[model samples]
Target chain A: QKEVEQDPGPLSVPEGAIVSLNCTYSNSAFQYFMWYRQYSRKGPELLMYTYSSGNKEDGRFTAQVDKSSKYISLFIRDSQPSDSATYLCAMSGVGTNAGKSTFGDGTTLTVKP
Target chain B: DVKVTQSSRYLVKRTGEKVFLECVQDMDHENMFWYRQDPGLGLRLIYFSYDVKMKEKGDIPEGYSVSREKKERFSLILESASTNQTSMYLCASSYGGYEQFFGPGTRLTVL
Candidate 1:
């Protein structure tokens, strides 16, 4: 099985709606989880980052991690048209392995007006 | 602000030709990485460097190599490029954490 799994969603939603993107991993050694946003033809940029399990909120984005279930999620509040982009979930283990991150296929989101 | 710049935005190369994709980060980050992004494959790491002249192979390193002659610059080299090497190449840099700043990405097409 793949170390990490995420649905490649071309999910469409209206503006001002709440969006939830999620990913699951098979590796229990993963300790750090991250979310990245990528626009078309551009590189992925860090959106949210969390270490271990719990929740982290920044601006309109919230990242949650549950190590027990090896599941991670990113929620976008008050989604806007500008928020339309591909969201990628990435995770890594501790120590030297921290530099090595495994990424999901990414979920594409489109927030329309 | 952290800035990562790639040498090219788009490139078209012939098969069997050597290809060089360069990346430079102004943040002087301790770690730099090279990854290829495909339609369904997501982002797969090709290589990474922790310090100057220090390099490590990532998940997908075959048919690719890397160089870190300076602290700010990391390069990805494709020896005898093939059609399979056609993909968007992304460069990222970080300071020993999960936060990595990515470059604009180079879309390479091997014909």
Candidate 2:
């Protein structure tokens, strides 16, 4: 089984709606969680980052990590057309080699205006 | 701001050709990584370097090799390009945490 699992969603929603993207992992050793946003024909960019099990908020995005359940989520409030992109979740274990992360398949979101 | 730049934004190569994809970062980051993005497969790490002259294989390192002769530059080499190697290749650099800065990907088409 893949260490990280995410729903490959081409989810479409109207503008101003709330969007939630999630991912699950089987590796309990994972301690650092991250969310990345990628546009068409572009490389993924770091959106939000959190360590261990907790929640971090940045602008209109919120990232939540539950270590016990091995689940992580990104919530977007008031979604806009500009927010239409693929969201990927990644995690890495604690140690010297923690820079290497396992990534999810990614969920593609389209917010229509 | 940290910036990562790739040698090419798009490349087309024939099978059996020796292919080289280069990446350079402005930030003096210690960690550099190479990854390939494919449909439904997400980003798969090909190789990574922790320091100059050091290299490590990632999960899917077959058919690929990496060179890190300099701290700011990393290169990925495909000994013999194959049709199956066609995909979007991405390069990233990090200072030592989960946050990674990525460059514009290089879309490679191997025919």
Q: What tens-digit string does per-residue lDDT give for candidate 1 at B1-111?
A: 999999999999999999999999998799999999998888988999999999999888999989999999999999999999999999999988778889999999999
Q: Is the docking of candidate 1 incorrect, acceptable, medium or high quality?
A: medium
State which candidate has the highest lDDT.
2
In order, what lDDT does every prediction score? 0.93, 0.94
User: Ten residues in a row with the worst lDDT in model 2 chain B?
Assistant: B94-103
TM for every model, in the order presented, reads: 0.96, 0.98
Q: Per-candidate interface C-alpha RMSD? A: 1.1, 0.8
* Number of the predicted model whose DockQ against the real structure is largest: 2
> TM-score of the A chain in candidate 2?
0.97
User: For candidate 1, lDDT tens digit of each residue in A1-113?
Assistant: 78999987889999999999999999888888999999998888888899999999999999999988889999999999999999999998888757668899999999999
After superposing candidate 1, which stretches have Cα over 4 Å from the reference?
Answer: none
Per model, state how many residue pairs clash: 0, 0
